[model samples]
Target: MKKFDKERLLLAVAGPVIALVAAMVLTSVVLVASGKSPVEPYSLMFQQATYSDVQVLIINEAGMYYLAALAVAVGFRMNLFNIGVDGQYRLAAMVTAVVGAHMSLPAGLQIPLLIVVAMLTGAFWAGIAGVLKTTRGVSEVVSTIMLNAIATSVIAYLTLDDKFGVPVGNNNTTGVMHESGWFPGIDMGDSGEIYGFVVVAALAGVLYWLILNRTRFGFDLRATGASQSAAAASGVNAKRMMLTAMLVSGAVAGLAGMPILLGDVHTYSLSFPTGLGFTGIGIALLGRNSPVGIALASLLWAFLVKASQALDYEGYDKEIAVIMQGLIVIAVVVSYEGVRRWGLRRQQQRVGEELAAAARAAGDENNGNNDSVKEVAAR
Candidate 1:
């Protein structure tokens, strides 16, 4: 059992490492094919990533990615694809920004209240898809894609009027949140300010780990994901688990935009960052839906995003960065599956050897028992 566990751990760790190496090699080939020096791009990327200001930016960006990926991972563990995280976070952020703008409470109360409202709004929006899935057999993918459009339209309509938005220069946006509602930034000497909600993202990762690995509900969720029919036979309520997963996913998605909204922009505007939720899907896949893996993947993804900016100055197409990211995700998913199959084969071989050895020992004991009985009878 100990050996088996060690092998499992080794495989888990090695899978990602192998995947990354494979991805780098493939990306280099692509770069060479395009007549670019792979070494130059990678060197530039790493050099820029090492700068203090760039490091802070990477962390801040990674924080948001981490939260977004966590949101997607929750649904993934339950076999759900929550593509609506984009819509959920955007709508939640807009509503929270609007609410925060109207309130003038102390920072302690206002921030939490804003966050709660965001979570509730996101939950409600995602719950619609879950409810439809359970009650009307609607596919979450189709429903979520439709929900994204609906969310965009809703935001468009709401922000066009003075009721939910105010004109700021040429753009429409929610009123700026009061200082009391803003999260303070962290100073890093010469590195300017890092978004304080990085801590929140860390806490979310810890909580996700605990809930998915250390709770009974998590067991039911994993079981259902493994085999819904088996989980049902074991008395797990598939519908209830699905609903809970979706709600939790959306609630986390609510936080995906909070760091940028509360820590920097302090408003939800037409210029707010979008499509991060979709990016989360790729990050989650690259991480294999694990917390630690997701954090690392988020950082790597953020680094690439930051590093890509330097390409414009270096006379290289920035689109190559996107291609690398896409290739990494695809390569990682395939490599992980390959590693899983290899691990399964090794485990099966070990089990077979153990069973064979046990059978031989049993046969020897039976022969010894017969010889003893015959000797006793002769005496």
Candidate 2:
């Protein structure tokens, strides 16, 4: 490959490596301070990964994480922070579950209907923040934050026994979906079943890459992210792009929790998964907003989670994984900035050298012309 391309790739790889090494080193120190062996936890985690069931669990979880990260990355692309992903996801899942529970349609039709319902629900929820941002000039961060709280209250109200929720021992839930509404998964016998939505997530990643890298709307979105003034000067509708981005982001987020509900849990209960959206921000940042990078990040995160389960039995705090994850994201942010500055410096130096060479060549050419002119005059 070209030298410049190689350098870019090297820098790209270097950021993640630097972050990982820094995080590991700090985690080791923390483990030592706690009078625990860091190596032991890692070793046990690796051994646990050898089990097929654990591997299956990791894949299923990774798929869910991939979708959440994608949703967050969409906003990241537009320089918008949709912190309300958790709310959008939960509210969508809850409503989808309720709607699906009430239906008795066939799998082919029912599955798509539930999914569409989920996406629309999330879009409408997130669209509120988008509309407020475009019309009221409210910051997306502030608006999304408020929306998350409002979503929480709305969910709480919906889950009341007097509403659509059913009592389940200690927790209230949207009643389970019928068999026809369930998304069929890949059964791994005794090992476990892989969520079918994982395949859908993979497709989503492909679409994300294609749309962002290969379309006019993506160009407008990214250009606006880089500089709204430049994009607006170019005739791109910045407000429209912002609203569209939010709608797209929340729609993907709506799918984030569907795997767990449709493929495994079959209901939206108080025990249903939460915080996946928050975790996605870290993954999206770590991955640098690349679809493939995000997939790898999600897998790595899922691995850490699966490994943390055994840390408690090893006399280590399972929260170590959480600590490590936090450290990784922080380190990545710092390292990426450092690499970016270094790259910028290198590029400037390269440009300076090229300009100097061009100047020297021009000077030589001018001297030769002058010498020829003098010789011709003498002749």
Candidate 3:
């Protein structure tokens, strides 16, 4: 049994590594077909990776991305699909920006209030889909997708109108938010763009881990995810769990938008909240839904994005960077699924063996009892 467990563990660890190598090989083939030297680009990427500022940038960016991915993972844990994170995040940021722009509150009150409001806005947005799924029996996937379109349209309409719009001269953007609402950066001299939000993200991760691993609510969620019928039989409320998961997912996603809205831009704008939600799906998969793993994966992704931006200076194709992102996600998913299937098969085999052994023991006991009866009857 020890050996079998060890073998399974090894396979679980090795599978992703093998898949990454395979992905690299496949990418190399594409590079060759394009008449580009894969070796040069890869070497350049490594060279850029070694800089200290670049390292810090990766860390900062990764922390934000990981937070967003964690939101998606929370839904995944409950077997609830929440593709509406994109919409939730956008609406939250927009609300926060608008509030910050108009409010005259002090820095201490304003910042926390914005963060709280953002979280509530996101949760409320996601709750709409949750309500539809529970009350109307609507599929969350369909509802969330439609919600995204609705959210986008709403933002567009609000931003275009003179009464509420940001003065972007007919463009969809909000006015600059007040300085009091901005999140301050942790200033390490000569370090670029590092914010206090990294610490917030770490705290968020710790809180998430606690919520998922130490709470009864989390147990119910996992139970429902494993099997809805079994969860129901065990007195778990699967529908409530789904609703809770989506709400939590949206709150986390809203928090994730803070770095961009409060740190970098200090305002909401059209296309400003772009792609992070979708990118989070890839980050979550790469992280394997584990907090530490997700943090590491986010950093790797950040590095790739930063490196890709550097390509413009070297006259290299920026599209290659996007390709790498897609490839990594594909590789991670394929690897995780393969390893999961292998583990399940092993578990099933173990269960079968245990059942067979129990049957044999029962049969032997019955035979022994029969023999004793026969001897007594003969006497």
Best by TM-score: 2
Q: Which structure is stronger by TM-score: 1 or 2?
A: 2
Q: Count clashing residue pairs per candidate.
A: 0, 0, 0
**Residue-by-residue lDDT tens digits, candidate 1, 1-379:** 6987999788878777887787788888888998989888888889999899999999999999999999999999999999999999999999999898888899999989998999999999999999999889899999999999999999998888657879988999988888999998898888888999999999999989998889999899999999999999999999988898899999999999999999999999999999989999989988889999999999999998988899889978777778878888787788888988998899899999999999999999999999999999999
Model 3 shows how many backbone clashes?
A: 0
* Tens digit per residue, CA lDDT, model 3, 1-379: 6978897667656655766676677777788899987777777777888887887777777877987898899989988878888888888888888888888588999889999999999999999999898888899899988998999888877776575676675555677888888889876577576877788898998988898899988788888988999999999888888888889999998887888788888878765846777888888877778788788778878888876667767767867777878888788878888888887898899899999999999999999999999999999
How many Å off is the CA of 333 in candidate 2?
A: 1.3
Give all TM-scores, in the order shown: 0.96, 0.98, 0.89
> What lDDT does model 1 reach?
0.91
Mind giving the per-residue lDDT tens digits that candidate 2 earns over 126-178?
99999999999999899988988898899989989999899999999989889
Pairs that collide, model 3:
none
RMSD over all Cα atoms, model 2: 1.0
Model 2 lDDT, full chain set: 0.93
Comparison by lDDT, 1 against 2, better one:
2
Model 2, position 218: C-alpha lDDT score = 88
TM-score ranking from best candidate downward: 2, 1, 3
- In model 2, residue pairs whose N, Cα or C atoms come closer than 3 Å (at least 3 residues apart or on different chains), thus clashing, are none
Clashes of 1: 0
Assess each prediction's global lDDT (C-alpha) against the native.
Answer: 0.91, 0.93, 0.83
